[model samples]
Target: MGRIIAVANQKGGVGKTTTAINLSACLAEKKKKVLTIDIDPQGNTTSGLGVDKNMVENTVYELFLEECALKDCIQPSVMENLEIIPSNINLSGAEIELISMENKEYLLKNNLDAIKNDYDFIIIDCPPSLNLLTVNAMVASDTVLVPIQCEYYALEGLSQLMHTIDLIKERLNPKLEIEGVVFTMYDARTNLSSQVVENVKENLNKKIYKTIIPRNVRLAEAPSYGMPVNMYDSRSAGAEAYRFLAEEVIEREDEDAWL
Candidate 1:
């Protein structure tokens, strides 16, 4: 079965969605079957993969909150090895609606179970808040990947996020683990970026990824064209960073395989 991971950060504009999109693309580039679920109401991951919002008949919101089948929402992406379950603005109401349902926390997990064997990985792109949606993602995930930006005060809200993860670990998903911490939007020219990286290296858990995503304009512009950085500009630094991250992930999985 595929391992489910949630790429999440409560802080906004931390390159969470960007990481999710490009990471999925890079993983697929490695010949790994990947399924990305966009649970954010903003649907940036949907558009980032060139999925038209209007054409989406079913979404992760429907699969979780409405008991829709996973197959109903899953759609092929432009990449041969990649697929996506897109979300729309209508997903915003799902959080509130899900609250009143029974076994609400398990909805996402249950939904993913059916499609788990279809891919090597299921990546859930979480919303930029610690709301019911985030809780759902946490409960559903086997591991969590957090993307922290390189900037002053970038650690703000991190305590809250960690506390929530701890709580979830204790009360909900004991099997859930942090996949890694990834540094995004790193500016090599700035001393602060270097400081932030140093702090993260010293303070964070040992699994922090080695690939630091640079503040590349091409990374920012790719989404506007509804494409992943790999497909948009494979030669760009941002794309290469994600590809390197994917290689690391592949190596880690290979190690796990030997175990």
Candidate 2:
């Protein structure tokens, strides 16, 4: 079965979509079959992976509304071995529509289950809120990978995010676990960045990946070109960091398998 991970952080601008895009790309580069699900209505992940979200005929929104099959929603990305279930602005209304539907939380889970064994990893990019879509992502995923930016307010809203995960684990998905925490947009020149890292380490009792993503201009620029940092500029710090993070992810999975 595939290891489904949701890259989630209710706090926006924390590199959640960035991590979701690059990590999935890097994993695919490593010869792993990867699938990315863009649950965020902004469709940033979809566009970041070089898919034209506005042009897609079938999206997760259609899947949720039963207008299309799960397989129909899957589209090939620019990167080999990486597929995506694109989402668009239309998904923004799914929350209200879901409320009236039965087992709304399991809608994503049920669809994903049929395709679980087809890939090695499934990465979900969740929205920046604890809405129904996020709940659906959490319910469908095996673990949640949180991206915390290295800034002054890095720890803000973390507790509530954890609490939401706890509730999902307790009520919806009992097997759900926290994959780990990754530090993003770290600036080595600033003492504040290190301070925030140390603060999160001291406060949060979650596994912290050793690889820290630096704030690189190339990283920021790659998205506009609809390419991952690795594909855009493999030598950039941002690309290297995500590659190391992907190795860490695979290594952790290997260790878990051994355990």
Candidate 3:
């Protein structure tokens, strides 16, 4: 079965979509069959991989509300080994519509189970809220990759997201675990960035990813062009960081299990 990893953060502008797009690309670059599911209504993940929104025949929204098959919604991306189940603006209505359905939280989980084994990894780009949609993502995922932007209110927004995860673990997916906490947009020259890094290392029980994503303008611009940083500028700091993060992720899959 594939590992369903939800790249989530309740706070917007925390690099959630950025991490989802680039990390999936890097993982696919390593020859792993990868699939990205855009659960966010923003559709940033879909566009980040160069998928045109107007051309999408089906999307994750249809899987939830339009009786569309999850497998059929998956669109092949620019990357050879990566596939994406795109999400467009139509998903915005799924929140209220889901309330009337039976087993609301399990909708995504049931839809994803059919094609879990088809890929090595399934990365979910969660919506930036603790709504039914985000809950659905949490219930569907085996693990969560939190992209914490290194800023003043970094840890402040985590309380609710963590609490929601706890509730999901207790009531829904008992096997769910935290994949890791990654620091994104870190400006190492600043005292604030260094302090945040230290705080994450000293306070959090979860494994802090060794690769910290530095704040890079190139990383920000890549999405506007509908590309990952790796494709946009392979030598940029953002590209190098994501590549390192991917290697660390693969390494930990083997080494940490032995420890």
Candidate 4:
């Protein structure tokens, strides 16, 4: 079965979508069959991977509502070996609609189970909130990869997210584990960035990836161009960092398989 990972952070503007997009692309670059799912209503990951979210006939919303099959929603991205299940504004009301549905939390999990063996990795770009959609993603995923911005309030609300994860693990998905945390927007010149990293290392008990994504102009500009940083600027620092992160992720997966 494919390893399903949800790239999530309740805090917005912390490079959550960026990590999801770039990491998926990098994994595909390594020749891994990747399915990147944009569960975020904003659909940034959809567009970031060069899919026109507004143009897609079938999206994650339709899949969630059972309007379409999971395979129907899966669309090929511009990048080879990377496919996407796009999302749009239609998903914004999913939380409300799902509230009345039976076994709503397992809806995504059940759907994904049928197609899990087709890909090597399935990366979910969750909405930047601990809403019903996020819960669904958590219930569906094997692990959660959190992106923490190297800013002053880096640790704020982190405990709440951890608590939410714990609750989900206890009540819904016993297999759910934190993939690890990756630090983003690190500035080499700033003492604050270093301090923030140190602070998280001291306070957070979860695994932290050694790859720290730098605040690169290319990384910020890639979304506008509808391409991942690796494709937008392969030589850039952001691309290099994400590529390294992908390597680490694959290494960890290998270690897990060995055990």
Candidate 3 local lDDT, residue 116: 90
lDDT tens digits, residues 1-259, model 1? 7888899999999999999999999999999999999989999999999899767888887787665777888888878899999999989998778767898888888777777888898899999999888888899898889999999877788878888998999999998887888899999999999999898777765477878999999999999998899999999999999999888777765544211
> Per-residue lDDT for 13-74 in model 3, tens only?
99999999999999988898999999888899999999997689899888998577776898
User: What digit string (tens of lDDT, one per residue) describes model 4 on residues 113-212?
Assistant: 9999999999999998999899999999999999999999999999999999999999999999999999999999999999999999999988888899
Candidate 4 clashes between residue pairs 3 or more apart in a chain or in different chains: none
For all candidates, what are the clash counts?
0, 0, 0, 0
Candidate 2 residue runs with Cα over 4 Å from true position: 254-259
| Residues forming the 10-long window of minimal summed lDDT in candidate 3 | 250-259
Off by over 4 Å in 1: 253-259
Estimate every model's Cα lDDT from 0 to 1. Answer: 0.88, 0.94, 0.88, 0.94
Report residue 20 deviation for candidate 1 (angstroms). 0.3
lDDT of 4: 0.94
Candidate 3 Cα deviation (angstroms), residue 77: 0.8
RMSD of each: 2.4, 1.9, 1.7, 2.0
Q: Which stretches of candidate 3 lie over 4 Å from their true place?
A: 255-259
